[model samples]
Structure formats: C-alpha cells, structure tokens
Target: MGKIIISENVTLDGVVEDPTGDEGSVSWFTRIGDADRAAWAEVEHEEAVGAAALLMGRRTHAYFLHRGWASRTDEWADRLRALPKYVVSSSAVADAGWGEATVLAGDVVKEVAKLKEEVTGEIVVYGSGKLVPALLEHDLADELRLMIYPFVVGTGARLFPETSAVKPARLIGARPVGTALALLTYELVHP
Candidate 1:
C-alpha cells in the first residue's frame, strides 16, 4: 500500500493559512530572505521528486491553478505539472486540467483508502486544510511533513485541531531548512 503524506507550510504557532498574505494576514512565509526562500524551494523540489502523486482539496487545487504554478518553467514547477493529482471536492469536475488529475467527490475515506491500495510510494498532500483534518480523523493519513516558518500568526487556520483523542506520531526526521525554517517529518502510529 502507498503512504499518504500530509505536507504543509505552517507558521510557528501552527497556522497554515495565508502563506502569501494575500488575504490581509501576515505572510510569514515571505518574511524570510531570498536565499532562505531558495533553500526551502530546493527542499520542496526534492519532496516533489520523491512523491508518486499529489493530493489536495479543491480550493488548493484551484489556488495553484489560478496562480499559474503549473505554467512555470522551473524544474520544480515542471515536476508538479507532470505528476498525477487528486483533488477532494464536493462539486463535480470533469477534469482537473492542470495535469493527469481526477476529482474525488464520493466518500473521502473510501476514495483515499482505495487510492492507497492502488498507488505505490508517497502520495503527498499539500495545502489541503480541510482534507488533512478529515484524513487524520479517519486514520487515513500515514505521515506528516511540516515546513515550519519562524513567525507566529496570532490567528488563522491551524494544522491540528483541538482533539481529545491523542494521535500518536513518531518523529522520523527533523532538520533546519534555512535560517528561519524547519522541516519536521512524523509517521503516524495506528492501533
């Protein structure tokens, strides 16, 4: 079975929303220097290269499409454009149009469980705020790769919601990705 990995860019306080500050929120991601940003990009590219496919929510899929990330000429962008994508959405979408993608609109748990059985290697999820929480709740997510920024956004969307049931995760890797960013990888332990 393939591993479902939730990869996210989060702030120090665990906020995962408004990385670009386009929504009038503080953009902690862009606060870092150019070299630091480049370092983070390099790390992201490596992750992309290792991933067998990309998974995300409809909003995130649209956000990247609208921003023209698929249209870029860089190696990282090209890799993203080439990968197969799966978008979790409620509405019907004939085609993703970004690349080889399919819209998953049925029971998310069933669809993702089947996807894990069908594919091999890492199935990486990026910026799927709603989907991530649901996946975790359903015990569908296998791993989490978080790129933590230095700034703490006082208020915004969070990666982990308030949960009474403790989800046990084993730390697999941890490293600094520049002067201001840190990359932490955790493997979720299921009972």
Candidate 2:
C-alpha cells in the first residue's frame, strides 16, 4: 500500500492558518522572510516531485488552484498542476478550471484507503486542517512531514487538533532548513 503523508506549514504554537496574511488571524508569510521562502521552495520542490497525488480541503485547494499553481509556467506550478488532486468538502464548490480534481463525497477514510491502493507513489495532503484529524482518527495517515517555523502564533487553526484517544507516532527524521524552519518527519505507529 502507498503511504499517506501530510505536508503542512505550521508555526511554533502549531498555528497553520493564513500564514500569508491573506485575511486571517496570524501572518506567518511575513515572518518567513526571503531566506525562509527559498528553503520552503526547495522542500516543496522535492515533495512535489515525489508525491503521486495531492489531497486538500476545499479552501486550500481553491487557494492554490486559483493563486499559485494555476498556471502551468509558474514556478513549481507544473508539479502541482500535473498531479491528481482530491478535495474534501461538504459545502464549498470546486472550480471547474482546475484540472483532474475529484471531490471526495462519501466516507473520507474509505475513499482515502481506496485512493491509497490505487496510487503508486506518496499520497500527499497539504494544508488540510479539517481533514488531518479525520485522517489521524481513522489511522489512515502513514507519515507527517511538517515544516515548522520558529515564530509562534497564539491564535489560528492548529496543525494537530486535540483528540480524545491517543494515536501513537514515531519521529523518523528532522532537518533544519535555514534558521527559522525545520522539517520534521514522523511515521504513524499502527497497533
């Protein structure tokens, strides 16, 4: 079976929302600076190349599909545009222009498991706050690759929401990218 990995950008306090100051609570994009952007670019490039498919929530999918990865000529744009994308949302509608996007309508875990079986490479989830906890709860996520920024945002969407039950995970690796960001990889330990 293929691995389901979450690749997210989070603050020290675990805030994962509106980092680009795009009308949200905390501004993480401003804090990242130029050097940090370069580091992130490198990380994204590597991840994009390895991932066979991209899974995202409605908001995140619309954001990237409209903003950065829409154009085929845009930097690292082809990587995102080419990959098969799955969007999970009950209310929000998807853009018709975004190529090869399938809305996940049924049971999220079952759908994801079906996708994992079909995919040959890594199945990557990016900035899907609502979907992450569900993935974890269902024990569907195989790995987590977090780009942890040093700054703390006290209020915003968190990377990991509080769960009633404990799901064990093991730290597999850590790599410091520039001064502010660290790439942390963790593997879920199945019982």
Candidate 3:
C-alpha cells in the first residue's frame, strides 16, 4: 500500500505559509549557498523520483502550475514534471497547466485511500497547507518529512493547526542538510 508522506519546508516556528519570502516571509534560508542548495535538491530528487504520485492542495497546484515547469530542461525537473500530480480540491480544475497533472479522481479522502490501495510506493504531499489539516483530521497522513530552517516566523499559516486536540507524532529521523537546515522526519501515531 502507498504511504501518505507530507513533505514541506517550514520555519523553526512551524510556519509553512511561505518560505520563498515572496511577501517578506521570515526565513534564514535566503542565506543558503550553492552547496547547501544542491544538497537539498538531491534529497528532493530522491524523494520525488521514489513517489508513486504527488498530492497537492488547490492553491499550491494553481501557484505551481502557473509557474510552468514544462520549459525546464534539467533531468530532475523533467522527472518532477513527469510524475503524476493529483490536485485535491472540491471544485473542478479548469486546467492543470503542469505536466501530467490532473484533478484527483474523486473525493479527497476516498481518492487518497484508493490511491493507497492501487499503488505500492509513497504518495507524496507537497505544499498543501489546507490539505494537511484534512489529512490529519481524516487520519490519512502516515509520515511527515519537514525541512525546517533554523529561523522563526512570527506569523503565517502553520503546518499544524492551533486547535486544542493534541496529535502525537514520533521523530523517526533527522538529517542536517546544511549549516543550519534540519531535515526532520516524523511518523504520526494513533493513541
């Protein structure tokens, strides 16, 4: 069965809203060098290549599709573009401009469960802030692989919601990708 893996770049304070600093997002990652960037890219490539498919929230899907990856000629970019992308949204997607991307076949939870039954690899989730909450709510997420930068954002949408319910997760592994980046892996546990 496929494992639902949530992969994201977050701040030390758990903010996943915007890491690219498009709207003054606080992140020390802007100081990363070529070596560190390349190291991170290699990790991303491995994960992307291993996944059976990608699940993205509508907003993330729209933003990314608008960016247009088809013009990129790099091997890693090619691999990323070729992977089947399932956008999770209630409304119909007008068009998935990104290569090989489509609106999920059915309801998010049901379709995700169906995907797990049909595939034996990982079902990777990327940049889906809104979808992550649903995954947690429906007990669908299996693993979390967050690349946390060594900085704090005072405000923004956090990966985890601020509700009273306490979700339990265990640290599975940690990899330091650069001078300040921590690739933290966690497994969600039901109690």
Q: All candidates' lDDT scores?
A: 0.89, 0.83, 0.80
lDDT of 2 by residue, 1-191 (tens): 67899988888888888888787566776777798788888889889899889888888887886675665585577777788888887755555555678888788888888988988889899887789999988888999898988887788878888876888889999999977889999999977
Q: How does model 2 score by TM-score?
A: 0.92
Which consecutive 10 residues in model 1 have the weakest lDDT in total? 92-101
Residue pairs with backbone overlap in model 2: 19-29
- Model 3 lDDT tens row, 1-191: 88999999888888888677666766555667777788888889889888888888888877776666655677777877778778887776645445756677577789877877876888899888878887887778899999987777688888888544677899999989966678999998966
TM-score on alpha carbons, each prediction: 0.95, 0.92, 0.88
> How does candidate 2 score on lDDT?
0.83
Query: Which scores greater on lDDT, model 1 or model 3?
Result: 1
List, residue by residue over 1-191, the lDDT tens digit for candidate 1.
88999999998899999799888888787889998999999999999999999989998888888887856889999899888889899875434346867888899999999999988999999998889988898889999999988887799999998655789999999999988889999999987
Candidate 1 segments exceeding 4 Å error:
94-97
Instruction: Give the per-residue Cα lDDT of candidate 3 at 106.
Output: 71
Candidate 3 Cα deviation (angstroms), residue 163: 5.0
The residue ranges of model 3 lying beyond 4 angstroms of the native Cα positions read 23-29, 94-97
